[model samples]
Target: MRPFSKSLAVQIFVGTIQRLPQSARPSGIYKTRVNMPVYLNINGFEGDQQADLRVHGGPDKAVQLYPVAHYAALIKRFPELLGKLAPGAIGENISCPDLNEQEVHIGDLWQLGEALLQITQPRSPCSKIDEKLDCKGVAAYIAQSSKTGWYFRVLEPGMVTAENRLVLVESGNEHYRLCSILSLMQQNESAAIGALQRCLMAPGIADNLRLKIEQKIVHLNRASTGTP
Candidate 1:
């Protein structure tokens, strides 16, 4: 594992569970920027809540980090969303400049303030994004573009704040870049089977994500052999 030489500033955000007025479904996507320090535990930051534990807010998906650069690209793609979308628009807990899917790898570990965090997997964009942004196809656009951010699991809990900087302590497999993993996930052909297998073996990978990858490989193998 290699150490990241430079540290990047972190902007923190957190939100509580709220019911969407349109769908009545509970969501934690509407985050507010935090100027003060907040405690981060194995589950997540204090005051942050996930409506549905089945899909969000666990040890594996404790914190979500989105790149600030992607917001510019998104606005360029959808000019109408110029004012609607920004750093915390996507429900990310952290926004770091120049740190997108391509720059990070699965299983990478970083120190934020006094806490330790490990990159687990790329966040899967859902319909909630469309609802939150009040625009259709935003979720699909993020998924297709592979601009979807990634999640982090807390390895050592401590207080963190926007003033903190994310310093890489340990690097994950360079072969399993978050962008490549997200791309491979969208490809179901036999050609992607091998790559998917290797991604599953990456250290610090989220259990739920690993299970999904394993299932994809099984499906691909079955398709190639005409077993179904």
Candidate 2:
């Protein structure tokens, strides 16, 4: 992997619950850029909130970082989303350039201003994304491309501002890059079993993700053996 810059400039975003006219369920996907400093805690930014706590906010998914580069590619493929999909449109808390899933490992740690953040897992795209963007298959495309951004768990909470940049303080399992993990997930059990086994051994993996992988392995084993 190539060396990352000492500090990568970042943009911070946050949102509250909002109910779109077309959807009955409220969502926090409509985020706006925060120009001032905000407190970062174990749960998330001070002003940030998710409509569904069951799957969105938690210690394991305190922050979401999306690459700005993705916007251009997305718009190119989905011209209809030209003005609809942009930075902060996908509920990403941190928007940074020159960084994507390919460059980040599962457990990489970074220092953002006064807070320490560790990557736990890739952000699982949900149907809410399609509703929010008013474009079908967008979420599925993100998953297939492995361009889906990853999540960060705050290791040390503190005040942070858009002026602050991300600095890599530590690296995690190189073999378990986010892109590779997502790719493995898209594969069948027979094709992904070996890599899945190795991924579970990686340090700093989210508890929920580990459980999911373990469960998948169990299901795969049963299927392979022709057992119900």
Candidate 3:
């Protein structure tokens, strides 16, 4: 398939450290941001670090992206979040316009600066976001709103700045959009069997996510046939 006609990078952020909350125990949340002109490799930004490696910062999740457009609406919903939430607040490395869950598909390849990237999967919104916001259910809100941004796997590593434009050089797995996959994963209903199956076969999908889909397919099949 052809690349999306346009994709723009509004800001670039790299994590500095995982910060513990002011009046709470260690949160393991990377709440700091780094300067631009950062190095991006298969592992992730060179200076960045994720407190929990089990759920973040791997080859399949080299880069985290959030749509800049989602910020305004989110701020309106939670006024307290107006100043607290900004680019990189949710652990995203790149903030972009025009790239949302609906339009970006798994396996889509992009050219950014001198590097190549492939859309791997949607970022599974976690409880840490709520902890960061000091408001419960914010993570669920992100999921329900479908504003949860997606992740990118580095195909070729290079330096990237905030102003570097994102060019979609290749499109992958048009059979499933990132939002649809996130919906299916969240709902896990038998109605999404076809989508789940396609996701399992889709190239560049994370192994853990693929396994989850496989399990869901088995569960759905057993339920449909009333098997034990």
**lDDT, model 1, position 214:** 92
Query: Which segments of candidate 1 are over 4 A away from where they belong?
Result: none
Model 1 C-alpha lDDT per residue in residues 1-228, reported as the tens digit of each score: 777766998789999888876898999988999999999999999999888789988999999999999999889888889888878988999988868887889999999999999999888889998887778888899889999899999999999877889998888777789989888888979999989989988999999889999999999999999998
User: For model 2, how does the per-residue alpha-carbon lDDT over 12-127 read when each residue is reduced to its tens digit?
Assistant: 99998999658779998889999999999999999898988999999999999999998888888789998787789888999998789888898888999899998999988898
Better of 2 and 3 by lDDT: 2
Tens digit per residue, CA lDDT, model 3, 1-228: 775656675577766555656455333345456556878899887787776688878899888889988888788788888778877778788788777888888888888888899888787788878877787777888878888898899999998876788988877666768878877876645787987888887778888778878888898888888888
Number of clashing residue pairs, candidate 2 = 0
Ranking by lDDT: 1, 2, 3
RMSD of each: 1.2, 2.0, 2.2
TM-scores for all predictions:
0.96, 0.93, 0.89
The alpha-carbon lDDT assigned to residue 160 of candidate 1 equals 88
| TM-score of decoy 3 | 0.89
lDDT of each: 0.90, 0.87, 0.79
User: How many residue pairs collide in each prediction?
Assistant: 0, 0, 0
